[model samples]
Target: MRYPIETLGEALAEGIVTGHPAMPQFELTPPEINDLLSYLKSLE
Candidate 1:
């Protein structure tokens, strides 16, 4: 899924590691990461 930011830091912190090589180029912020977690949680 795409995040608000453009970094993979947030996704990695959340244990959502992706095998895609381009993932490293993405940039994500703390708040945006939090939002991603919240959204992911709702999927449960």
Candidate 2:
């Protein structure tokens, strides 16, 4: 989409595979991101 699939995957994997480094923290695994992304795509 906006940043290319690989780019999006990387961003998702970061806070996911590792963990958010800053405040207001949250995390998502690869599978969770994929599911969220899939839901988002369905809205279009």
- lDDT for each residue of candidate 2 in 1-44, tens digit (9 for 90 to 100): 25555366567767533344565656788788898777767776
- Of candidate 1, the 10-residue stretch with the lowest lDDT total is 3-12
CA deviation > 4 Å runs, candidate 1: 1-24
Number of the top-ranking candidate, with lDDT as the measure: 2
Error of 2 at 10 (Å): 2.3
- Model 2's lDDT to the true fold? 0.66
Candidate 1 C-alpha lDDT tens digits along 1-44: 67544454445566665778776655557777678767766776
Q: What's the TM for model 2? A: 0.53
